[model samples]
Target: MSIHVVLYEPEIPANTGNIARTCAGTHSHLHLIHPLGFSTDDRMLKRAGCDYWPNVQIEHHDRFSDIPEKYPNAVFYFIETIGEKNVYDFDYSNPDADYFFVFGKETTGLPSELTDQFKEQCFRIPQTDLVRSLNLSNTAAIVVYEALRQQAFAPIAIKEAAD
Candidate 1:
Protein backbone atom coordinates (compact mmCIF):
# COMPACT_ATOMS: atom_id res chain seq x y z
CA MET A 1 0.00 0.00 0.00
CA SER A 2 1.11 3.56 -0.74
CA ILE A 3 1.20 6.58 1.52
CA HIS A 4 -1.83 8.85 1.65
CA VAL A 5 -1.89 12.67 2.01
CA VAL A 6 -4.94 14.14 3.70
CA LEU A 7 -5.67 17.87 3.64
CA TYR A 8 -8.23 19.04 6.17
CA GLU A 9 -10.08 22.19 5.19
CA PRO A 10 -7.30 23.41 2.93
CA GLU A 11 -7.79 27.09 2.10
CA ILE A 12 -5.39 27.69 -0.78
CA PRO A 13 -6.05 26.15 -4.15
CA ALA A 14 -2.52 26.71 -5.41
CA ASN A 15 -1.00 24.96 -2.39
CA THR A 16 -3.36 22.06 -2.82
CA GLY A 17 -2.48 21.85 -6.50
CA ASN A 18 1.22 21.87 -5.75
CA ILE A 19 0.74 19.15 -3.17
CA ALA A 20 -1.20 17.19 -5.78
CA ARG A 21 1.72 17.37 -8.14
CA THR A 22 4.04 16.15 -5.40
CA CYS A 23 1.65 13.33 -4.58
CA ALA A 24 1.54 12.37 -8.24
CA GLY A 25 5.29 12.23 -8.42
CA THR A 26 5.43 10.06 -5.31
CA HIS A 27 2.43 7.89 -6.25
CA SER A 28 0.67 8.89 -3.02
CA HIS A 29 -3.09 9.22 -2.74
CA LEU A 30 -4.58 12.61 -1.81
CA HIS A 31 -7.69 13.12 0.32
CA LEU A 32 -9.33 16.51 0.66
CA ILE A 33 -11.71 17.16 3.57
CA HIS A 34 -14.27 19.83 2.92
CA PRO A 35 -15.24 22.58 2.97
CA LEU A 36 -12.42 23.54 0.67
CA GLY A 37 -11.34 27.10 0.15
CA PHE A 38 -11.76 26.90 -3.61
CA SER A 39 -13.45 24.80 -6.25
CA THR A 40 -11.79 21.77 -7.78
CA ASP A 41 -12.16 23.43 -11.14
CA ASP A 42 -10.35 26.56 -10.02
CA ARG A 43 -7.93 27.75 -12.70
CA MET A 44 -5.13 28.49 -10.28
CA LEU A 45 -5.32 24.99 -8.92
CA LYS A 46 -5.30 23.52 -12.42
CA ARG A 47 -2.39 25.71 -13.42
CA ALA A 48 -0.37 24.71 -10.36
CA GLY A 49 -0.94 21.01 -10.91
CA CYS A 50 -0.41 21.47 -14.63
CA ASP A 51 -0.39 18.26 -16.68
CA TYR A 52 0.11 16.10 -13.58
CA TRP A 53 -3.48 16.47 -12.41
CA PRO A 54 -4.53 13.34 -14.22
CA ASN A 55 -1.75 11.39 -12.56
CA VAL A 56 -2.84 12.37 -9.07
CA GLN A 57 -5.29 10.10 -7.29
CA ILE A 58 -7.68 12.38 -5.40
CA GLU A 59 -10.59 11.77 -2.99
CA HIS A 60 -12.98 14.10 -1.21
CA HIS A 61 -14.38 13.75 2.30
CA ASP A 62 -17.13 15.61 4.15
CA ARG A 63 -15.47 15.27 7.57
CA PHE A 64 -12.25 14.06 9.19
CA SER A 65 -14.12 11.24 10.87
CA ASP A 66 -15.09 9.82 7.48
CA ILE A 67 -11.50 8.79 6.67
CA PRO A 68 -11.06 5.97 9.20
CA GLU A 69 -14.27 4.35 8.05
CA LYS A 70 -13.01 4.39 4.46
CA TYR A 71 -9.45 3.18 5.09
CA PRO A 72 -10.01 0.91 8.02
CA ASN A 73 -6.57 -0.67 7.99
CA ALA A 74 -4.58 2.47 7.41
CA VAL A 75 -2.41 4.08 10.09
CA PHE A 76 -2.65 7.88 10.26
CA TYR A 77 -0.06 10.46 11.36
CA PHE A 78 -1.23 13.95 12.10
CA ILE A 79 1.27 16.56 10.87
CA GLU A 80 1.52 19.86 12.70
CA THR A 81 4.07 22.49 13.67
CA ILE A 82 3.91 21.69 17.38
CA GLY A 83 3.69 17.92 17.30
CA GLU A 84 5.27 15.96 20.11
CA LYS A 85 7.60 13.97 17.88
CA ASN A 86 9.72 14.68 14.84
CA VAL A 87 8.80 13.16 11.49
CA TYR A 88 12.05 11.17 11.43
CA ASP A 89 11.19 9.52 14.69
CA PHE A 90 8.65 7.23 13.07
CA ASP A 91 9.54 3.94 11.43
CA TYR A 92 7.88 4.19 8.06
CA SER A 93 9.97 1.42 6.56
CA ASN A 94 7.36 -1.27 7.02
CA PRO A 95 6.62 -2.40 3.52
CA ASP A 96 3.29 -3.96 4.41
CA ALA A 97 1.97 -0.92 6.23
CA ASP A 98 -0.17 1.85 4.81
CA TYR A 99 0.40 5.36 6.17
CA PHE A 100 -1.76 8.44 6.01
CA PHE A 101 -0.12 11.83 6.44
CA VAL A 102 -2.78 14.27 7.62
CA PHE A 103 -2.22 17.99 7.24
CA GLY A 104 -4.40 20.92 8.12
CA LYS A 105 -5.58 24.06 6.32
CA GLU A 106 -3.36 26.96 5.33
CA THR A 107 -4.53 29.21 8.13
CA THR A 108 -6.06 27.66 11.27
CA GLY A 109 -4.39 24.25 11.17
CA LEU A 110 -5.87 20.98 12.36
CA PRO A 111 -8.59 21.19 14.93
CA SER A 112 -7.42 20.62 18.53
CA GLU A 113 -10.00 17.93 18.98
CA LEU A 114 -8.56 15.84 16.16
CA THR A 115 -4.91 16.36 16.96
CA ASP A 116 -5.46 15.69 20.62
CA GLN A 117 -7.17 12.43 19.86
CA PHE A 118 -4.24 11.30 17.73
CA LYS A 119 -1.56 12.71 19.97
CA GLU A 120 0.46 9.53 19.92
CA GLN A 121 0.78 9.67 16.15
CA CYS A 122 1.32 13.38 15.85
CA PHE A 123 4.57 14.43 14.09
CA ARG A 124 6.29 17.65 13.26
CA ILE A 125 8.96 18.72 10.80
CA PRO A 126 11.45 20.47 13.03
CA GLN A 127 11.84 24.19 12.50
CA THR A 128 13.04 27.10 14.61
CA ASP A 129 10.75 29.60 16.28
CA LEU A 130 11.96 32.11 13.70
CA VAL A 131 8.67 31.60 11.82
CA ARG A 132 5.19 30.43 12.62
CA SER A 133 5.27 27.64 10.04
CA LEU A 134 6.30 26.66 6.59
CA ASN A 135 4.11 26.87 3.52
CA LEU A 136 1.49 24.15 3.25
CA SER A 137 2.69 22.62 -0.01
CA ASN A 138 6.31 22.74 1.07
CA THR A 139 5.53 21.02 4.36
CA ALA A 140 3.63 18.27 2.57
CA ALA A 141 6.49 17.70 0.15
CA ILE A 142 9.02 17.52 2.96
CA VAL A 143 7.02 14.99 4.96
CA VAL A 144 6.07 12.87 1.96
CA TYR A 145 9.64 12.75 0.73
CA GLU A 146 10.89 11.81 4.18
CA ALA A 147 8.46 8.92 4.29
CA LEU A 148 9.46 7.88 0.79
CA ARG A 149 13.10 8.09 1.68
CA GLN A 150 12.59 5.92 4.75
CA GLN A 151 10.91 3.34 2.57
CA ALA A 152 13.79 3.33 0.08
CA PHE A 153 11.67 5.28 -2.37
CA ALA A 154 9.81 2.15 -3.29
CA PRO A 155 7.41 2.15 -6.29
CA ILE A 156 9.27 5.25 -7.48
CA ALA A 157 12.12 3.88 -9.58
CA ILE A 158 15.38 5.72 -9.16
CA LYS A 159 18.18 5.34 -11.70
CA GLU A 160 21.74 6.51 -11.39
CA ALA A 161 23.32 8.48 -14.21
CA ALA A 162 25.66 6.69 -16.56
CA ASP A 163 29.35 7.08 -15.81
Candidate 2:
Protein backbone atom coordinates (compact mmCIF):
# COMPACT_ATOMS: atom_id res chain seq x y z
CA MET A 1 0.00 0.00 0.00
CA SER A 2 3.04 2.24 -0.38
CA ILE A 3 3.93 4.36 -3.37
CA HIS A 4 7.61 5.12 -4.10
CA VAL A 5 9.08 7.85 -6.24
CA VAL A 6 12.53 6.86 -7.52
CA LEU A 7 14.91 9.42 -8.93
CA TYR A 8 17.71 7.78 -10.88
CA GLU A 9 20.95 9.75 -10.82
CA PRO A 10 19.08 13.01 -10.44
CA GLU A 11 20.88 16.29 -11.25
CA ILE A 12 19.18 19.59 -10.40
CA PRO A 13 18.74 20.22 -6.69
CA ALA A 14 15.68 22.41 -7.06
CA ASN A 15 13.97 19.79 -9.15
CA THR A 16 14.77 17.10 -6.63
CA GLY A 17 13.61 19.36 -3.83
CA ASN A 18 10.38 20.10 -5.63
CA ILE A 19 9.79 16.41 -6.27
CA ALA A 20 10.56 15.70 -2.62
CA ARG A 21 7.93 18.21 -1.65
CA THR A 22 5.44 16.53 -3.93
CA CYS A 23 6.35 13.17 -2.45
CA ALA A 24 5.80 14.53 1.05
CA GLY A 25 2.39 15.91 0.14
CA THR A 26 1.31 12.64 -1.48
CA HIS A 27 2.72 10.50 1.33
CA SER A 28 4.96 8.74 -1.16
CA HIS A 29 8.40 7.38 -0.30
CA LEU A 30 11.35 8.99 -2.09
CA HIS A 31 14.29 6.92 -3.32
CA LEU A 32 17.40 8.58 -4.67
CA ILE A 33 19.83 6.60 -6.80
CA HIS A 34 23.34 7.91 -6.32
CA PRO A 35 26.03 9.69 -8.30
CA LEU A 36 23.81 12.69 -7.63
CA GLY A 37 24.70 16.03 -9.16
CA PHE A 38 24.37 17.93 -5.92
CA SER A 39 24.60 17.20 -2.22
CA THR A 40 21.33 16.44 -0.45
CA ASP A 41 21.92 19.37 1.89
CA ASP A 42 22.36 21.95 -0.85
CA ARG A 43 20.90 25.35 0.02
CA MET A 44 18.72 25.38 -3.08
CA LEU A 45 17.32 21.99 -2.21
CA LYS A 46 16.61 23.00 1.38
CA ARG A 47 15.01 26.23 0.25
CA ALA A 48 12.80 24.67 -2.39
CA GLY A 49 11.77 21.89 -0.07
CA CYS A 50 10.90 24.44 2.61
CA ASP A 51 10.89 22.11 5.64
CA TYR A 52 8.81 19.44 3.90
CA TRP A 53 11.90 17.25 4.04
CA PRO A 54 11.01 16.46 7.63
CA ASN A 55 7.80 14.78 6.50
CA VAL A 56 9.17 12.85 3.53
CA GLN A 57 10.05 9.16 3.69
CA ILE A 58 13.34 8.98 1.81
CA GLU A 59 16.04 6.42 1.02
CA HIS A 60 19.31 6.53 -0.88
CA HIS A 61 20.92 3.80 -3.00
CA ASP A 62 24.27 3.36 -4.63
CA ARG A 63 22.80 1.61 -7.60
CA PHE A 64 19.35 1.07 -9.11
CA SER A 65 19.75 -2.71 -8.80
CA ASP A 66 19.90 -2.32 -5.05
CA ILE A 67 16.29 -1.19 -4.91
CA PRO A 68 14.84 -4.25 -6.66
CA GLU A 69 16.94 -6.50 -4.50
CA LYS A 70 15.70 -4.81 -1.35
CA TYR A 71 12.06 -4.68 -2.36
CA PRO A 72 11.67 -7.66 -4.63
CA ASN A 73 7.90 -7.70 -4.48
CA ALA A 74 7.47 -4.07 -5.41
CA VAL A 75 6.26 -3.21 -8.91
CA PHE A 76 8.52 -0.81 -10.81
CA TYR A 77 7.35 1.50 -13.58
CA PHE A 78 10.06 3.44 -15.43
CA ILE A 79 9.17 6.69 -17.13
CA GLU A 80 11.01 7.26 -20.43
CA THR A 81 10.48 8.98 -23.75
CA ILE A 82 10.86 5.75 -25.67
CA GLY A 83 8.35 3.83 -23.63
CA GLU A 84 5.51 1.93 -25.28
CA LYS A 85 2.76 2.53 -22.74
CA ASN A 86 0.94 5.71 -21.77
CA VAL A 87 0.78 6.88 -18.17
CA TYR A 88 -2.90 5.95 -17.79
CA ASP A 89 -2.59 2.43 -19.14
CA PHE A 90 -1.78 0.75 -15.84
CA ASP A 91 -3.98 0.14 -12.80
CA TYR A 92 -2.27 1.38 -9.64
CA SER A 93 -5.11 0.54 -7.27
CA ASN A 94 -4.04 -3.01 -6.48
CA PRO A 95 -4.32 -3.14 -2.72
CA ASP A 96 -1.53 -5.64 -2.20
CA ALA A 97 1.00 -3.90 -4.39
CA ASP A 98 3.83 -1.50 -3.61
CA TYR A 99 4.52 0.81 -6.56
CA PHE A 100 7.65 2.63 -7.70
CA PHE A 101 7.66 5.22 -10.45
CA VAL A 102 11.22 5.74 -11.70
CA PHE A 103 12.28 9.02 -13.23
CA GLY A 104 15.65 9.69 -14.90
CA LYS A 105 18.20 12.48 -14.89
CA GLU A 106 17.06 15.76 -16.38
CA THR A 107 19.75 16.24 -19.03
CA THR A 108 19.71 12.66 -20.38
CA GLY A 109 16.59 10.69 -19.62
CA LEU A 110 17.22 7.19 -18.28
CA PRO A 111 20.22 5.01 -18.95
CA SER A 112 19.78 2.60 -21.87
CA GLU A 113 20.82 -0.27 -19.66
CA LEU A 114 17.74 0.36 -17.54
CA THR A 115 15.39 1.22 -20.35
CA ASP A 116 16.50 -1.88 -22.23
CA GLN A 117 16.10 -4.18 -19.28
CA PHE A 118 12.73 -2.77 -18.27
CA LYS A 119 11.31 -1.78 -21.62
CA GLU A 120 7.94 -3.28 -20.84
CA GLN A 121 7.77 -1.35 -17.60
CA CYS A 122 8.67 1.98 -19.13
CA PHE A 123 5.95 4.61 -19.71
CA ARG A 124 5.46 8.04 -21.23
CA ILE A 125 3.12 10.94 -20.60
CA PRO A 126 2.14 11.14 -24.27
CA GLN A 127 3.18 14.42 -25.80
CA THR A 128 3.40 15.92 -29.27
CA ASP A 129 6.61 15.46 -31.26
CA LEU A 130 7.18 19.17 -30.97
CA VAL A 131 8.66 18.88 -27.47
CA ARG A 132 11.57 16.78 -26.33
CA SER A 133 10.14 16.27 -22.87
CA LEU A 134 8.52 17.97 -19.96
CA ASN A 135 10.29 19.45 -16.96
CA LEU A 136 11.62 16.85 -14.53
CA SER A 137 9.76 18.11 -11.47
CA ASN A 138 6.57 18.61 -13.47
CA THR A 139 6.75 15.11 -14.94
CA ALA A 140 7.27 13.60 -11.52
CA ALA A 141 4.22 15.42 -10.22
CA ILE A 142 2.10 14.23 -13.11
CA VAL A 143 2.89 10.54 -12.71
CA VAL A 144 2.78 10.58 -8.93
CA TYR A 145 -0.56 12.40 -8.89
CA GLU A 146 -1.99 9.99 -11.44
CA ALA A 147 -1.01 7.05 -9.27
CA LEU A 148 -2.54 8.77 -6.25
CA ARG A 149 -5.74 9.45 -8.14
CA GLN A 150 -6.12 5.77 -8.96
CA GLN A 151 -5.25 4.67 -5.44
CA ALA A 152 -7.81 7.09 -4.00
CA PHE A 153 -10.52 4.56 -4.84
CA ALA A 154 -8.63 1.53 -3.61
CA PRO A 155 -11.33 0.66 -1.10
CA ILE A 156 -13.81 -0.11 -3.88
CA ALA A 157 -11.19 -1.97 -5.83
CA ILE A 158 -10.27 -4.04 -2.82
CA LYS A 159 -13.89 -4.85 -2.10
CA GLU A 160 -14.48 -5.85 -5.70
CA ALA A 161 -11.43 -8.09 -5.66
CA ALA A 162 -12.45 -9.73 -2.41
CA ASP A 163 -15.84 -10.69 -3.83
Residues 31-119, candidate 2: write the lDDT tens digits: 99999998877575556646878788999999999999999999999999999999999999888999999999999999999999999
Give every collision pair in model 1.
Answer: none
Instruction: Report lDDT per candidate.
Output: 0.90, 0.88
Output the number of the lDDT-best candidate: 1
Please list the residue runs of candidate 2 whose C-alpha ends up more than 4 Å from where it truly belongs after superposition. 42-49, 153-163
* Model 1 Cα lDDT, one tens digit per residue, 32-140: 9999998887575556647788788999999988999988889999999869899899998888888999999889999999888999999898998999999999999
Clashing pairs in 2: none
Candidate closest to the true structure, highest TM-score: 1
